[model samples]
Target: MIFPEGGGRESHRKEEIKQYYRSFLWSLVFTVPVFLIAMIFMYIPGIKHALDTKLVNMLSIGAILRWVLSTPVQFIVGRRFYTGSYKALRHGSANMDVLIALGTNAAYFYSVYSVLRAASSTDFESTDFFETSSMLISFILLGKYLEVLAKGKTSDAIAKLMNLTPGTAILLTLDDEGNVISEEEIDSRLIQRNDVIKIVPGAKAASDGFVIWGQSHVNESMITGEARPVAKRKGDTVIGGTVNENGVLHIKATRVGSESALSQIVRLVESAQMAKAPVQKFADRISKYFVPLVIILSISTWLAWFLAGKFHGYPDSWIPKSMDSFQLALQFGISVMVIACPCALGLATPTAVMVGTGVGASQGILIKGGQALESAHKVNCLVFDKTGTLTIGKPVVVNTRLLKNMVLRDFYELIAAAEVNSEHPLAKAIVEYAKKFREDEENPMWPEAQDFQSITGHGVKAIVRNKEVIVGNKSLMLEHNIPISIDAEEMLAETEGMAQTGILVSIDREVTGVLAISDPLKPGAHEVISILKSMKVRSIMVTGDNSGTANSIAKEVGIETVIAEAKPEQKAEKVKELQAAGYIVAMVGDGINDSPALVAADVGMAIGAGTDIAIEAADIVLMKSNLEDVITAIDLSRKTFSRIRLNYIWALGYNLLGIPIAGGVLFPGTGFRLPPWIAGAAMAASSVSVVVCSLLLKNYRRPKMLEHLDIGGIKIE
Candidate 1:
């Protein structure tokens, strides 16, 4: 029932056919005893003697009764194969169902006619009446039942995903001072944009919306592939199907129905299922030739046996056994068809991808699809954006250099007062530093800043306490006709050598002191680079900052390659350059400027808590902003692809060894033949093996760095 009348109609049809086969299995159970009774009348000597002595004239009546009961059983329970074979033959193609329907019905009608003709003959035996038809029908039904169960296991992932969408929604109406009012309860479709929907604790959200008020943690694992619940506040987006951990939220719907992120995720997953893997193409090519070859060989086998009987000096007495030879050939051909099913070949790649994606979700790494997961394993080079990807993107005061005959605290106060109205990150750093060093009497009672002006890429100027205060770079000082003294130049050179942004402070047209500000590297950034080195991934940094600052941070993180002073378009070009050099590059960043580069890379991994543009452009978005997930994602892809290969080998290898044995290749010289029941059982065993192989992938162990390294030489302190 997981498949219904919709876009996935083919999947639904396949399930319906499987269920029909299961019903035939139940019919086979009921008909076994009837088959045994017919066999007893023909083979047992006592029963045959009694039938010949007392009811010899009634044999025609008995044959008619057998025909009446068994015809419905064959046509009704076995009608599925008959219809399928008819369709295949009409299209000039033959498959396993064609062989089963033709072989079994031929054996049945042959026995029926033989029994009826023998009623007039004086010397007649019913041995041929009971042997062929019952065996073929029983075996084919068994094979079909097992095939259904295995195919069900292969498609479990899609069924589980469909179960995520909730069946109902709660529509909010109105709230009085101390009372609640309820409107008419309606379906999810009636909910419109900007409508307030009340989500109870532990219930799945019905639509994509933003929280108007209240707080809770929502589990967005099904949509974003993250297992942990993310905390939501007012103005934060919530996706449908995610569970609310606690607290009620009055959410205003942003996207309803198919436009929601949850719906897009479901659509993506379903599309992945429809894609055929490379191994299935091989099976399709092989099947194109397999059916015709089997049919020709079966005809040749019958002709060879019939001609040999004629050449051996046997007369009309050899006619019965010659007919038996043709029946045997038909039986072998049917067995070959049933045992060579393509279930494993089709399931190999998709099952591994489904499980791999699920495992990645638990670790907070979101992979878009099978292609992305496959390509991630082969990435050789990693390029990074500098502002938010490498550095923390927050400028801070790193050092304070006092000029000759200048006080450090006074220098900080003047700079802070001059930048009081500035909004740049650099300005905030100076103000925060002044606040940290503030003293009761040391606080400057400067007049309110006036005519504040900011020079792009330089600094700010303001009139403080009626004195012109300049806090800017060297260029800003020269533009204002303020001369930098010998002491100020010496201090600026020292700050530049330390890879710091030098902010010159001048009061009343004279240089006072220098303030150095720079964006600090993120914590554990160096360790992340070292880990990438251990994994053999080449790391490079690209930035819009000056060459000195770029190289300074790159050296701290142990990265040797740096692209300095790059604009947004230039950063994307650098990614293309790395890719042109035969490297599968991955760009990691967290800013609007990095969007183009993120889209151009082989794998775009966005650090969480970044700009919305960067996150949208990335293929795999890291929810925790931890660099370690890059290694985790690559390791996951490698393991997943390895499993897919193993499954394909096992599935194809089993059919290669099975089809020949089912064709009676060992029959002529050694008088050996594969019984139909054994062929049915072997087919079931092969299907079970494929399912078990897929399930074993759930136990794959993700590689950990600590397990393979010695950290004793690296001091943790």
Candidate 2:
């Protein structure tokens, strides 16, 4: 899943940096003498006297010394460029290596010819450019050394995550009666499923497990991004890599190794770095043609310069000292080829994405990859599911009313029996409320229902004590031919108006009672909607609740668009409708019922506390399940893409101005020419600059406005 279109080449980057450093050392050792002999040493009176001595018919001692020192640098230290060029050409393409090989070889082989021709002829005083080729390779290697060093830094977040796991765990041996027999320290990686482990104070959890024998506060800020430590009692699951703070706890391991949350977070961040962004196609297409086009341009520059010089198109003073038309033309050609870079363009996308995704992971937002990050920035509309997304999701019985003559305890007992087998939040709410009527509060026994049937978006039906009990909304009561009386209708209306769901109980096909349950809006829900509006993103609430209750909650949250009583399939269809209208839509939800909508939206975001299916279907997961993270995800993506755009501009701008200058485009007017070695250094610098620009995203933080809210001109920090 690692989309490597722009920059995510995470393979042996450290090794490559080491190799570049090694090659640079070799290049420096040989190239320094060539430069010294040609430039500085030859200018000295004593050195000039010895270097000017004729070694052959016309070749001087300086020429021979420079050639011998530069030969190893050209053929040994620069050999990698040759191999890379051959591989690129064999594959019917070209790259930075091809340009480096061509430019340096042109200078070196021509110098060899000049030296041989001077040795054979007494009158021929040849100017050999042995220093140009050797110096070019040295400077380029230095640039690569710095570039690889920066590339290695972009994945530091993942490295930190991997380091969170503790090395060892205290595994406990339990007897048949669940009493601890013995405890021994073992490697954390050796822990298996169903093993009991003891975590002392301040120790990190070795595996994902529920507390079995103790209570303590566990700090889960690594996963949830919350600073507060959560209280963990028996049956509360603790994530691996989280520190147990106050008390010792015995835990039964549920997930081990890579199945643990910390490992999965690392894998997801790695995958995000690997995936390619949509805009990377622009750089990719340009790169495919960039090298060959530069080669052709190099040949044209040489031809133009040679033709101009041969026909007296320019003044004689235009040529540098000891260089004629052909040699002058050769220098311009080498400069053009050396200065044109493809590496900068290739790195413009992936590096920024790596840093951006890593930053998101640290803040409890798990963006799938470049595609999701790209989509998030452009989202103009967002659909929110009400129950678990904007509301607390945990419902409680706030009120209970009786329609017929029935003992309240007997009535709750029957309702609790029918709901005991169901896993819905509302069902659990009723069962918990009914527990007060039993003498054994902790372990209450309920009457068994003969046949229990649970209906989606409505309620449950069961046969309890020879009575046909139906518990659900008004639609379910009518579907079973049960009529709602005036008093029941008034109560249902009053409950819905209060933003509470009304569940009716029908005993033996007659209406008996109504249970009013309410799930309060999540904290900062209203502020989140207002912030989205200020960001120019429309927020809509979609729920399966009745219009009255849905509208009441939506009004409180400052949402204008509400779609109530929507089935699972209908939610997805609504997302399609928004997309059809040319809007980029994002769906935020937290249940298995929200999976379809999550998959259908342009960017699907799921609450981390939701069902597994919802998380799997989502493109982004809000690990904290907080409303503020939605804004953080969008703002982060926008900032990351802005950095990417800046990279592209820097890379492309460098080439557009560099190629012409190196090719002698300004020589006719200014009488100034760029050297081939300087051109090679500029090419290397361009790539390093692009990578450094991407690395700057590592310092990114969520917006200050998000951290401190201003609602109604009052600051809420």
Best by lDDT: 2
Q: Which residue pairs does candidate 2 place in steric collision?
A: 2-274, 2-275, 3-274, 3-275, 3-276, 7-350
Candidate 1 structure quality by residue, lDDT tens digits, 482-518:
9898877877767766766667888888887777778
For model 2, residues 1-717, the per-residue Cα lDDT tens digits are: 112221234446766888999999999998998899998987899999899899889999999998999999988999999999999899998898998988899999999999999999999888988999999999999988998788788888777777778989999999999999999999888999999999999999998999989999999888877666889998899999899999999999998887888878878888888899898989999999998999999999999999999999989988887899999999999999998877899998998998899889888899999999999999999999998788888889999999999999999989999999887788889998999888566779899997899887778999999899898888888889899999999999999999998889999999999889999888888989888999999999888777788999999999999998887898999999999999899999988778899999999999988887899899999988887789999999999999999999999899999989999988888988889999988888898889999988988887776767653354533
Model 2 TM-score, 2 decimals: 0.93
- Per model, state how many residue pairs clash: 0, 6
lDDT score for residue 281 of model 1:
58
Model 2 ranges with Cα > 4 A deviation: 1-11, 407-423, 438-454, 461-469, 478-482, 507-509, 710-717
- Looking at candidate 1, the ten consecutive residues that score lowest on lDDT are 708-717
TM-score of each: 0.68, 0.93
